[model samples]
Target: MRSEMPYANISGTAVAIPVTGGSLAALVRLPTQLPAPTVICCHGLLSSKDSSKFAAIVEDLCQAGFATVRFDFSGCGESRSASEASLLGTRLRDLLRVMAFVQEQDWNNGQLGLMGCSLGGYLALLGAADSSSVGVKALVCWATPFDLAGIRTALESGNLPHAMATASRQLGEPQDLAGLPPLSRVLVVHGQQDATVGWRAAIEIYRRMADPKELLLFEEADHRFVDPACRNMAIQASTDWFRKHLAGSP
Candidate 1:
């Protein structure tokens, strides 16, 4: 049996975006008594708040005295699947909104961190890697994809969703939020044997990142991290990243 990880619905947005014509929801898990730092969890492509993997991470973080908020990307989960036609930009905007929401919550005044898996991981670093990531104190990614255009090219010959290209092409150079110091801290964890997204992508991302970043390569791990050791490693590294940065540790 899985140990219970207490989580409560913190708030819901009536209109996530007017263009999407739907609402977005966020569920929060707070550390006991004294408020704790936060990890904004973003799920991967085609996944949602319903993903068991995300739930497991959320539970782990919460149990470790860290607060986390996980929400469904518009058109991905309970929010609005029909809006997928406009998905690419919609998800990025949704991430921006989620960040805004996390900063506003009562329990998140402390350092804010991010944990995103796969595609989610890509966007997390992309968001925080650039100067725009306000309130983003740290980042954790797993087998994250970079170079959105490359992914699009791979799918061009297939019947893959057209929305992928439409959105990837337009997400643009991430916004360089004015007035904020450059984002210098980052942590990336990827499977060296990942065949789906491949290890090359992760290395490429690592190169694009600035200093103060660490990448954990799981030698025998695959894309899903299905192996018990790999899964445990992913969890440990992610939790460790948050604890060190969010708690201001050396």
Candidate 2:
């Protein structure tokens, strides 16, 4: 028999967050306590809040006493807008709006945290790195790409905005790194055998961040952590990191 442990009370509500083009379809999970710390979950390219990996992680976070919000980027899930493709800046703006929306809720303490996977991870790091005013206190990134050039090359063959195509060339181009605010604490996780994006990107991100950071490389896992054991480890690590950093903060 497995050992039993008490989990924090959790509840979820479906809500639409207003954005420029349309409302973002999102699910907000709360830990039954008011003014609690919250973590916004960002999904990878072509993924949404309902993605299996994200859903599992969100559940773990909620049980660990953190409020979690997961939403679909424009054009991806139930959101109303339809962009031919998601731009880096657009994703950043959406996250900022989510931050604003969360702040309005009386139940939130305004102590924010972010967790992202793959492309989402890249956005999380970018958003938190420059988030002096947004109040992002901690970040968790899994298999994030450090550069946008590769993404552009892979997706640009399809329909994409001219400006977005041009912008991708500039993002993650070293100059972008200069503008990113220093992060207080960070956790970077990557699969050792990831084929989509190399584990080296994790190292690059670690190099860019300040102290009080950690990196975990899992062997025998792919980009999505296809293996159940790897996935479990990833969820546990992410939940623990957020708990350690986000606890006791108003």
Candidate 3:
């Protein structure tokens, strides 16, 4: 049986928000039982909670007894704008807070898993590496830009003046580019034809991971995974990763 669980409208920094946008936050745990593990799926840039892939996974997992939650970044979706939303670092902090809430929930088995696309994937790894991630038993990232500084450097001297500098400022520091967590179990899926976020970045992240990681390369897909076959592959791979890692008893 499936049902709806009211989510808490948390006002925290889960993602970047512009100054002019409304409130930014997540849609918390919807009710379910059977003790199936919990997963939090995060969308990519300029995307909302109901992205086709995200919604598909949420529907599948909910039926399979896993309780799931997805929220908007400060400046995106039903939440606040990029200007008003918290900074990038603060947004990552908000993601952690969401995990804390999941741990507190009676339905969640205290084992958490993460699914993030694009920049969301980077936040997942950076934050997961830095903190004792709340119940993050496994992580699956799609097209995450792990090498942010490198990307910025490449984009330096672009048409938009101060673009690189502004992004650096928001990032708030010069990371050594060495502290990425040695991931235990991770799955990285990227489109070979992705122009926006090339597959190389995902490869770099996979290389930096600790162990028990798998990378699936899509030869003909692009950044959006719009090709029907590619989309199915991505979702199936992600679901399988979460299930294999998070499907056991507490």
Highest-lDDT candidate: 2
Task: List, residue by residue over 209-242, the lDDT tens digit for candidate 2.
Answer: 8877899999888999989999999899988888
Model 1, which residues run further than 4 Å from truth? Answer: 1-20, 81-86, 129-133, 153-182
Ranking by lDDT: 2, 1, 3
Report the error of model 3 at residue 73, Å: 1.4
User: lDDT per model, in order?
Assistant: 0.67, 0.77, 0.65
Ten-residue segment with the worst summed lDDT in candidate 2?
Answer: 1-10
Best by TM-score: 2
Model 1 clash pairs? Answer: none
**Model 3 residue 44 lDDT?**
68
TM-score of 2: 0.85
Q: Could you give me the TM-score of model 3 versus the true structure?
A: 0.77
Positional deviation of 22 in candidate 3, in angstroms? 9.0
> What tens digits encode model 3's per-residue C-alpha lDDT throughout 70-180?
877554567643331224554565567566666766666677888888867876776567656664778888877756664445444343332222343344332323567
Off by over 4 Å in 3: 1-24, 28-32, 81-86, 149-169, 173-177
